[model samples]
Target: MIRALVLALCGLATAATAQDTAEAALRAVQQLEAASISLQEAGSGRDRISALTETVQAYEAGMAAMRDGLRRAAIRERTLTRDLNTQSDEVAQLLGVLQRMGQAPTPLLLLHPSGPTGTARSGMMLADVTPGLQAKVDVLRAQLEEVAILRQLQGDALATLEQGLAGAQEARTALSEAVSDRTDLPRRFSDDPVKTALLLASTETLAAFASSLAEIEAETGAPPAPDATALKGQLALPVDGTVLRGFGDADAAGIERPGIVIATAPRALVTAPAAATIRYSGPLLDYGNVLILEPAQDVLWVLAGLAQVFGEIGQVLPEGAPVGLMGGDLSDAQAILTESRQGAASTRPESLYLEVRDGQGAVDPATWFAYD
Candidate 1:
């Protein structure tokens, strides 16, 4: 999932850059005629006006054509991410069926199967309780192949987007140079303030668009989550950071105890202490990017930091798959993660958050992890 998401984001970032380029080109086109007229009235050279006008018109047309394609690229990225997630889920179910038939995970150790027969043989016996389990597994294998194809498609689209962005940037550079060459024009427009403001606005607009896309992705449902029991003691600390608050820690005066706080820098990668499904993924009041992982019915874990998220909710994560990147941007607030509480105070921190919950209660993570 992390690889898929990273690819998706790379695509999105490329698209966003392309979109900005397109927008800038369009803006230049709109500004061209007025600028030309003004330059004419200001007694600018005919060649200067003509050059500016032509540049603007050309950029407008070029970027206009690229806009739809850029948007499509973004959409394609989103689609592939969503599809891969779904396929992974379907494949997992099929694997389950194979496991029941006593033929699951057939030696990927020897040779990776690329065709149907190898897949069928994998879950031949100890099959699932459900009918058509073998067929379903075959279908899943096929779908996995399809996922690979979609990934290639996504990569191609991203390349195209990158090309377009490069072209648009080149065009902008040309335009800026042209603008600079016309020295007789108003000097004020060439000042730092206007350019800075314009640049900021453009960048902010791009950031907002990216955030919107992320929100949309978040709204989408993910594949089947991992069982809490599956994660119990499967994960271990990856770094050393302090836990400012304990699981269910509250002062006698009623101050709430943080689930787990592992102090780390921005962009530190958070991983699952054990294999599990993400229970929560979002920024809570103060915890910048918080992830809750449940290791079992009586166990829950929380991870928080100031940074980008590495996984989505409901994602079945492995023991060390990046869960989130840590950041230190939010001051006076601590990021955290933990397992189900068994009721005790925790004293260990590796910049990784740990907590335990037993019967919906807080347990000291230190002893359980040490004992485990």
Candidate 2:
């Protein structure tokens, strides 16, 4: 009888713990739903992109929490089932004792001479079982409460998950609309096939690249483009991120390159800051993939360190146009290189390197872009 009562109590505690886990998981899902709503209502383009990236990460985490909660609940249910099975005979004995005690009149239950020691022994035995019986009743009551709580949590989680799915769909639509809004614009200069070929074949350094493109524009009588200078202090950053390394910061090699490195969420969106012509878009040196944009007749914007580049050379892009995505993982070629060097893979946050150059030299991008 004692063992059955103990097992019943253990089952109730296990079930209650499962309910607690489910409640925590439900809270996580609710938080993710709220984040999605925030992304939808975000005022700035940069904020919207940043929130969208975070929302994706939150969704992944929430799903994992929900799965873990369900798994724990299943384990608890199995444990309760096993405990009940093991205590089946004891439970039967307990039930029989209860039935007899209830059927007998109160005086007979306490004073009847029905044991080896007659009345004294009968009373002692009843006293021994009474505490265990009350404990069993308490366990039953707690189990009922646990079941009711678990049912409520399960219902709430289900509704939240459904709402989360709808919010995710809405987020995707917003992203699509944002991207489509910047696809078309006036070109800074028409691409000359001969000059384009020469520019790609001859440039070895960024300085040389800028000079060569400038010379080609002069020869082609490139029409005066819209002044990007007016956008200084007003232009939004191409990607949603924080600047990790600023202009003129020296690297390990002591080379002070003219660019800013931005740390962003994995696979974050990289957009055009202003309408420009795509001068070059492909792999370039240690920067991985890159995009060169000529927003004005003399100035060229260098955007690099991308996982993938979109569009093609000579493709004109409006302000806020989607250019590419930051890389998440290494490519097969990069992985092989790391293996050969016996070096661990990099786990750095996705980064974008930006440089603005013109007839004079590299200038502070902070002077132009709206960074905060």
Candidate 3:
């Protein structure tokens, strides 16, 4: 029964190890490489932008998987090492007993102090003990092998990390250039510079500025607004992240804003949640690199806190189009690996603020975005 229990524990450990996260990371790397190839073969303008976008996203996913795999490997290694240390004395005693039994002559091993009956009992006891001893040995061997593998995995991951980081940086550069060169998107209307400047100079709050957006537009035969009512409660968040603060939530400063704040990784890709026309795309009062989109008449989606913004004001953007990137410096391979080994959370220090407005009133973004 003891042997059976030990074997069961070993089997469970083996099964858990079989779900290799390192392999998942490798698959992500392959995807990143494929995306890089696609970007190289892409045509100019939107085609290149789309391909570059895919490349960047792939690299991001690959890096995340790699980091997770490394962290798990480090944890597993520590656990196995600790277990081995705890069992060292017992293992040594078991080995000594086995060695003595093996060295004894057959007649001497079979002999007992109480003669025949004692010898028969001793034989039965040895039979039971042998299997349990073997089970422990097997468990120890398996653990050692896993520790070695985990170490190798961590060591080999550095190269993969470097590749992913380089690929992501290159993709980001290409995406920036492609967006800058793009000029084919349809325009809704040109923004009046003087009116925008005057509004920015006088506007005291985001709500007030949003309410007066129509006053600064220089109309140039704009198309009919698309109906986005069907997309309500179905729109994806503009960026991949966790919501740090919900709409109307008070901060440490006791200030409540009618927007949801999202925490995201450095340079994370930001995209449009729905097909929309860009009403404004630039610096706002206190928000950094704000982008306001009109998905439907009298409705606006505002995204802020970006390091860079894409597309010009008054241009129509399809759903999922690249909008901007979150702000922060990308960590190098060594730094990322060290952090992963230490089991720290991936640096998601950048924040994106999102606000939804219907007519003249701000509403909770959770009502529209499917964050859950």
Give the clash count for each candidate: 44, 0, 0
Q: Report, for every candidate in turn, its global Cα lDDT versus the true structure.
A: 0.44, 0.62, 0.79
What TM value does model 1 have?
A: 0.30
The true-structure Cα RMSD of candidate 2 reads 13.1
Tens digit per residue, CA lDDT, model 1, 30-128? 454454555456544435534443433443343333333334443544555667687787667766755754754546523436666656654553345
Candidate 2 residue lDDT tens string, 1-372: 112212222333345474554454455555556666777788875556546545544443443344344344444444555566787787788888889878989876656555546888767877897898989867755655555654444433444444434444454446545544534444445656686667767768877877776665432444445467788778888886678888999877887889998886555667788878787778765677889888876788899998867666766665666677777742232232233223222234788999988775888888778786
Question: On a 0 to 100 scale, what is the lDDT of residue 292 in model 1?
Answer: 61
What's the TM-score of every candidate structure?
0.30, 0.48, 0.89
Candidates arranged by TM-score, highest first = 3, 2, 1
The window of 10 residues in a row where model 2 has the poorest summed lDDT is 1-10
The residue pairs in collision within model 3 are none
Writing each residue's lDDT as its tens digit, candidate 3 over 99-195 gives: 9988999999998999999999999999999999999889989999888877766666666667667767877887898888898788787757886
Q: What is the lDDT of candidate 3?
A: 0.79
Candidate 1 residue 248 C-alpha distance from true site, Å: 6.3
Off by over 4 Å in 3: 1-44, 105-107, 216-220
When 2 and 3 are scored with lDDT, the better candidate is: 3
Q: What CA root-mean-square deviation does each model show from the true structure?
A: 26.0, 13.1, 6.5
